[model samples]
Target: MQSSSKKETIDCFENAIKNLNNVRTLYTENFVNWKGVTKDSKEYYTEIIAEELINKINNENIISENIKPLERENYKVPSRGKTFISNTNRKEENVAKRIDKMECGELGHILYYQMPLKPNNKIKKVGKIDLVSFKKDENIVYVIELKVANKNETLLRAILEIITYYQQLNQTNFINSFKDDLGDKYKKVEIQPAVLLTCDCRAYEEVEQLDERPYLKELIKKLDVELFSLSLNIQSIE
Candidate 1:
């Protein structure tokens, strides 16, 4: 006869499998009837929903209590849309945190990640700067926008975002608030905007060409923002 603990473990596995089968059936039926939906869109939604269901099942307390832990292994979740798998694997926020630890000689003195910027009398935050560094020696402030992917669309959007941050920081009241945050060391600081890319993909070359466009070229010159790229290396250890 099966032991009580063994039976419970078997039951947990059965329930999880049953739930997954139900999810699959529902997904198939829904997709078949989903009119005007593109194939890629359908697949994206189905994969996301399936992953959510798996997560829910995996988190059940009953399963945790009854089943023994499985051996550790790497799992790759399906990518959605045009996103690169590497970006999701490493995570943009994680990369940004790592970058925050680097010394800033000309970059800045104090580095802040996800700094909130709100205009006067506004309750809602207008925007959150990805990274802000200050150089007390030169009285210069750097607003850095970090992106995991170097896609053209992503770079363009980041450019606009950093520009907005620079404009807001230039406001008289906003500058006063910034000075207060930085203390007396940075009494007068000039704002410099920048976009940092983690990957050296094809978009890097495209961004260079984009800089030559008359309107974009003028905007970059006027904002005095710099575009920089950094690469990350990873090795496996046995």
Candidate 2:
């Protein structure tokens, strides 16, 4: 459904976020009834409503040119930090390290761990990406967002966040940072958006089920975002 006004568009996104907590369990059972309806009273399937909201938000989203790169010392592929910015997401750190270790022929040889994105001088920091993998041989760059097996975040939330992050990145500034710091190998990389889910997570399992849903397939086709599931060797991140 095309949003007739900007407020309607914002309403769609705000509504989805408000209902985000229910998506993992109640998505298939709910519907996005008209605006102002209580969350409990909405009456429609999630994919149908979410598909519209996602398309709306994604179509309107654009990469802000304000993103600036840090100094050469900060662009290190194998990050020095062992913990996330929050210092609590050990599982994410573990996954990033594991991906960083893989051969370039595999998931990507060079990885950027918890890379901080600076939106502008005023904000200083916008957000930190989970990981960015560069495969030199194929000249492909994967902008990845990682979620561990125990994470309970919903599939829709993953879709929304990865899309937002991928779009928010300043491609021109980011590419310049890579070329100036990492060398010519990154000059022609093909950037792709991705979401990495630990094999047993709710989002992973939920995504597998989404494969048969046309709305989801359509959504993926529209976004061009890839979904991957990794089976971690360790028993638990705990």
Candidate 3:
């Protein structure tokens, strides 16, 4: 790659990393200069924004980071889940705990929940991956972000989180942490990012399309991530 081209790709990645969390509108709004849009031009302008983001996300030049000196919670659920998990996330943790205890069934066995990533801020608040698992007979590790029914998060936002975390996981550290659990085949198992959605979640609803392909679905297909609509039988404590 030319020096200029490589630099451009890095810039694209850094920009997306900063704007990812703030993205809410799927088609119309974007990180690019888009505030001046008019109603008539909204549809046309949206396509431009979508196409631009599509190019950025679909670009194969983005760099993936491996945070050396990586860490995990082993396979055990952390006690901080009770206090570290805020009331808002306590509800989410309820689901995380249930998934941790129950058999993965078609989803596969849980390796761990709340996988940590490098924190960008100085205060050192790290983001946690919802769940990580492996299939019974497959050489693939699933890094999953879960959204339960009626979650208010936009589909695009959830997609970004999984993609970012998948890129940030250190392969050597993750597998070696459970070397005894995976055996020699651990070297061959690849990390696959996934979104596990409970039926009727906002993320689930947004991806449902027949007349035309949803941009989010197209992006997921282009990025090669997995999507699963799972049915969990846990009764809500809310």
TM-score per model over all chains: 0.49, 0.65, 0.68
- lDDT tens digits by residue: candidate 2, 1-238: 2223434444554564554432222222223322222334332233555556556447643212221233333333443656433335577766676566465334565456677654434653245677887767677777777778654556655664566566666676667657743467766777888888878776786677775446656766676878877777644444
Task: For candidate 3, list the clashing residue pairs, or say none.
Answer: none
Residue-wise C-alpha lDDT for candidate 3, range 1-238, written one tens digit per residue? 1122333333543555565443322222232222223343333222233345577655632323222233442433346454232346355556776666355766688767776664333524346788878875887778898877655555655666677566656667777766765678788887788988887676676567412334545667765678877776535533
Question: lDDT for model 2, on a 0 to 1 scale?
Answer: 0.57
lDDT on C-alpha atoms for all candidate structures: 0.48, 0.57, 0.57
Q: Best TM-score goes to which candidate?
A: 3
TM-score winner between candidates 2 and 3: 3
With a 3 Å backbone cut-off (N, CA, C), the pairs that clash in candidate 1 are 109-134
The Cα error of candidate 2 at residue 176, in Å, is 2.6
Q: Which ten residues in a row have the lowest lDDT in candidate 2?
A: 61-70
lDDT tens digits by residue: candidate 1, 107-220: 654465655554333433345567767766677777787766433333334555566555445344434545655677555667778877655543354456563334444445
